[model samples]
Target: MPTLVVAVFLAFFAAEYAVETGLLLLNLRRARRSGDAVPAPLQGVVTPGSAARSRDYTLANGRLALVSGAWSAALTLAVLLSGLLPWLHQALAARGLAGAHRFVAFLVLVSAPFWVAGLPFALYRTFVLEARFGFNRTTPALWLKDRAKGLLLSAALGLPLLYAVYGFMALTGRAWWLWLAGFLTGVQILMVWLFPTLIAPLFNRFQPLPEGPLKERLEALARAARFRSRGLFVMDASRRSGHGNAYFTGFFRPRIVLFDTLVAQMTVPEAAAVLAHEIGHYQKRHVHRRLALGVAGQVVTLWALSLLVPWPPLYRAFGFAAPSYEAALALFSLGGGAFTFFLAPVASWLSRRHEYQADRYAVALVPEPGALASALVKLNRENLANLDPHPWYSAWHYSHPTLVERLRAIGEAGRPA
Candidate 1:
């Protein structure tokens, strides 16, 4: 490898890890010092004691992320430096697995170690940190079962898709990325269409929103928005964690799913407000906008990868042998993080903007914004969110606005009843 190539890669590599570590620690300190008192905006809305617990929860998660991030980064750095990819490529080549089959085998072989390696961290997060905070609901046996299902799910869907991509790459010559991009775009659409009915039920049970005031209110809210759906359902999400959430799923029609824990704690109006906010995402086209942006990104990245895969120097810079699709995917997967690390703020900004837009739509739909504001506070307290994070760190990490910001935005919204 040329000294310059190695130097550039290492520089970006080290910088990415350093930036992540800094953000984690900075947010941790900010949360710790934010104190136990609720910010004035939430003074009447949120209890003071909840703020302290939220800080503790943030701290716990920050600590976990710091450790896990460092461990994973170190593991990745070691693997790249240790020349593992080339060895794997040679072993598979010796077996004479050609075209799509080779990529499929490579995907499975490389993914297994990563999967097993992450098991300990997953276990620790669920059994230790989350349990300490009273959020964990998953058992050890259930965890293993989930992992097994995940592996099966990945193999069932991922292999065939990858097979087609590699096959098209070899057959169609230079335009393989365009073909792969279209193929991937189709897969993304398929998943969205099927996830609500076919895939989601594989892990959690989903039942029709039980007949009650909450259901009646949610149905009314849906009707007001003129959104059609498979009807509302309650997911047994609390079976795994105490954290509560609600979302819209499905490609053609909307499927509103509420976590059981969310329903249990929130008042009827507050629950209705939450669902309104979710429905707003659909009504406002935020979901489709995101999907379009993501598909575009895939197309661009695949096009770039098609250009890079034939370059031997790029592989040698990372201590790999001559270029192959499997090697290109592995290298790109490992190295893409470093190159895109700086784009974190931009992505977060877009997401937060979408969130605020959705929030405005909710305010317009609901009778009042107070219920959504109150619901946000309850969610912040229950989920142990960092009420105040350093602006820089939040810009890089937070998808939604801080509670204070959202409350202010909600107050400012003058949308008609």
Candidate 2:
């Protein structure tokens, strides 16, 4: 039976677009509802009765929405058109004009331009708009250097994987999902292993924590949470942005990285509160849960792609010349992207749940709910994060609970255990 692949692709896109736009509108309304109830510290950052300042924030959000929407649309179109290159390769093979591997190489070459198109917008958003907001400390030179490094690194690691995927689809099309899943899982494991030592240093500088009250408090919090980290390292995040963040990255080679921006302004107790949240993620097993969800999602997607690729109308629906291994890849990408668009809300909901769970774990372990609340307020103020995002927006895009929500949760947890 000929599958209406193009129709599936369009349906997927429409579903995603509707859900995303709806979520954004919901968040915008929530932001409006929060009104003057924004955390006290955040009020000082917004100049009261300053029309220009208000306009700037609104404009930035609008720009973010526009860029995000356009990006999704453009990439969808690229994936649909990509089927053309694969079809050409198939025709060449029929004429004995190219070997199978050459066709694979040609398909890979054709996809590079589409892959690179997103880079400029990403750079501009981080270096230009973020800089204008007094959030970026990264020099243009440093930004470009980092970008180049990322591209080279991705190509070095990803190219061979792509070739392997192509070979798997061509040779083991029936059980290709299992093979592809194993390969993908292996790559993920390798990346996790390399991230701390090889990947992270290419962007940020990490140093052992300085001797200070903050360090002592953090150690105490870590002990309370029953966690052990290799070292407390401070990252030079302030050089690139004013955003304050702390994360626990690396699995086997675990490290705790505090952004310099975080440490510079936060009090010792506040810093400890932040560290508690990171440790809470580990203590609650949120990382493992997230990984499980990711792997499951990948397996489902691979299985779906395997089914869709063998159907002939999928190629015709996308205006691809005929069914071929490479054509199947392009179709899968297009259709899969569309499908994931609607799936965003489901994933976002799960993520927000995990974040709330981690917050609960933090409050339970540290019993410093007040400090955690204060830290949340400070982080929102420093980062210029929207204190009053529409509830719908927060539900759809926010992985973490809103600052107010988090503080409220902390307050609720203040009861004697």
Candidate 3:
């Protein structure tokens, strides 16, 4: 049984790694073939220089991804196959650490190596890669501070939550997974609700949209769409990067936030169009539907974990002498992606469909027919987004449709039904 499990693990791992490497290489090749030429749909909208930059950006990031993905896969496989995890568990047990405390400590310790290994890549991506393209604005001090806060926040929130999960597992009998699933779903929803007000402020300052025409326009659009929000606000995203975005957080009374860079770059109509697209998400209930789907996924994952946690051979396959919930959870978390990687395209497709729906809904609400398309084109150029991507690569990776697809869809959206 152990041998079979190991074989299955290695097979899935190899397949996932091959697929990832192939898609990245294929995308890079496709980008090289396309050169700097702006896609037909975007020729007039985006300048040749911007298109060239976008191509370079894509190639650079793709190369980085290829390297980083291989490194990550290799490190993960090494850690899993090594007797290190079993040794660590035994060491922790030897130290008189037991139960949830020991489990949390073990997880924290095991995760440290990956975090340390990733720092250089994260730094390069943020400071070197992003800065080369005129996107990075974060100082090293700010970066360090942010990481510190993130770590502290993780410990504060994650430790307690993990302890609670352990408690549920210990006390809830055979249906523990069901209870844990519901609890986790509720926690997820609560985090979403609190993030806009509580968690977000820790990282970046957000201010009210400042009683301007843009604010009035966005509020009016929301009212027109019959979507209620806490308020419109702008985030100081420029403090970190030049990339612009807009999103709403929270379940009820969500706050619509626009990146300061977005506000600075886009015209009033363009901003309105962008906000209208976000509002469209709410109007179409995409947010609620996605949330429900996420909860369902969590339920399924927990149920699977319940089934696997007790199997002794599963532990033996990974070099653990005895079945331990912590080991099982760690192994599952580490290895589950290889098993479920094929599902990414399905998720991406659903997300893209939602995006299309939101875009169409925005078109109906925005005063100018081409406002949303114009905004999208500007965003793509400003963000140095790849205007063209290989079909298979984009299908598997992109949560939102490509800029060209979006522009074409926006045009269709303006037409009479």
What lDDT tens digits, residue by residue, belong to model 1 across residues 1-417? 445766877899999998989888888888878889787877876776888888888898889888888888878877777877778878888999877888889877876777777888888989999999999999989888988898899889888877887787788888988887888888888888889888889999999999989888888988898978888999999999999999888765878899999999999999988988888888778888889989888988888888788988888876666778888888788877788789888889999998998888888888964889889988988898888888889999899999999988988885444
Worst 10 residues of 1 by lDDT: 1-10
- Candidate with the greatest lDDT versus the true structure: 3
For each candidate, what TM-score against the reference?
A: 0.96, 0.87, 0.99
Could you give the C-alpha RMSD of every candidate to the true structure, in order shown? Answer: 1.7, 3.5, 0.9
- Can you write out model 2's per-residue Cα lDDT over 157-179, one digit (the tens) per residue? 76787778877777775898988
Cα-based lDDT for every prediction: 0.85, 0.72, 0.91
Per-residue alpha-carbon lDDT of model 3 for 285-330, expressed as tens digits?
Answer: 8989998999899989999999999999899999999987789899
Off by over 4 Å in 3: none
Model 1 misplacement above 4 A: 414-417
